[model samples]
Target: MGTVGITGDDGEFHLISMWVAPEARGTGVADLLLHAVLEHAGVGGGRIRLEVTEGNIAAERLYLRHGFRRTGVCGTVGGDRPEFEMVLDL
Candidate 1:
């Protein structure tokens, strides 16, 4: 298992670091956790955002199915891997 963070910045919430346990993969755990996070953002009147590695096609598709649009690409903060920034309007 990993962790997720929803940070408030100037009254807007940003969703980050969403990951599922290896044993939970393909079990709809990611979708359920993402939906719950989005619901929480909605209740707070904020939007959700996250970054996924460019090579992660499955995650990209999952976010797309969840209504998260690709906003832009960004460099990883402390790593060499590139990432795509996605946002969900809640």
Candidate 2:
């Protein structure tokens, strides 16, 4: 119901993508997927980063609860949707 992946090398990792089916929200699927990604990234003592869409409070809260902090970096998705970067030191 959910999945997440990482990219990058030499310890620095980026959460390339994460998604949980709408029907699976609040069912622990997202947590499981995030845990798996963190486990993989924790092999390196660097940091894991990801861009979350602005206004997606649920996702933002999930990352926050997982210890991710906003990095003050911002961007856009598809040339319109706003997004910001967050990081979790592993």
Candidate 3:
């Protein structure tokens, strides 16, 4: 499951949360879901952004494979380990 947060004042679409159920992972569910989100974002214009928890190499690779580039905006999330902001321009 996933959610696309509304465009902020700056018009950026934040892909808030995206995940596949454990039993559904690697069955192409995530790919279809992410495809829909990115397609919508691309059609709408502007940029799409998301944050991935630190040490999540699999998730990071998934985002990178979708064309999101890692920015220098790294910081602790929820007062815990780091998170990185990634973006894809539509």
Candidate 4:
């Protein structure tokens, strides 16, 4: 659970944060949460964005499977922490 919003200057809703309990991992909770936000008011069929850690393959794959394509590099580049932006137009 987390705050969901459209922080983009263009008003595109961004998926800020999402977390699933350890016991819920691999049980499809992440999928349901993602889909819920994507399907939220004024979000469905519209542009939405998110970022995932560079090495978090599971999350990257999950977003990709939901039709989100890589947009570009997110946050600080060449730093110890890096994330990639992904977007979906439902």
Question: lDDT of each prediction vs. the true structure?
Answer: 0.78, 0.92, 0.78, 0.74
How many residue pairs clash in model 4? 1
Candidate 4 off by > 4 Å: 1-11, 41-44, 77-79
Candidate 1: list runs displaced more than 4 Å: 1-3, 9-11
* Model 2, CA-based lDDT: 0.92
Candidate 2 C-alpha lDDT tens digits along 1-90: 877878987889999899899999999899889998888888867899999999999999999989999999999999999999999998
- lDDT value, residue 45 of candidate 1: 67
- Model 4: lDDT equals 0.74
Instruction: Please provide, for model 4 over 1-90, each residue's C-alpha lDDT reduced to its tens digit, 9 standing for 90 to 100.
Output: 332344443446778778888777898888888777766724435688888888899989888888889987578455768878998876
Residue 42 C-alpha lDDT in model 4 = 43
Cα misplacement distance, residue 30 of candidate 1 (Å):
0.5
Q: How far out, in Å, is residue 60 in model 2?
A: 0.3
Provide backbone clash counts, one per model.
0, 0, 0, 1
C-alpha TM-scores of all predictions: 0.82, 0.95, 0.84, 0.78
Indicate which candidate wins on lDDT: 2
* Candidate 3 stretches greater than 4 Å from native: 1-11
How many collisions between residues are there in candidate 2?
0
**lDDT tens digits by residue: candidate 1, 16-70:** 6777888878888888887777777787565777888878998998899999998
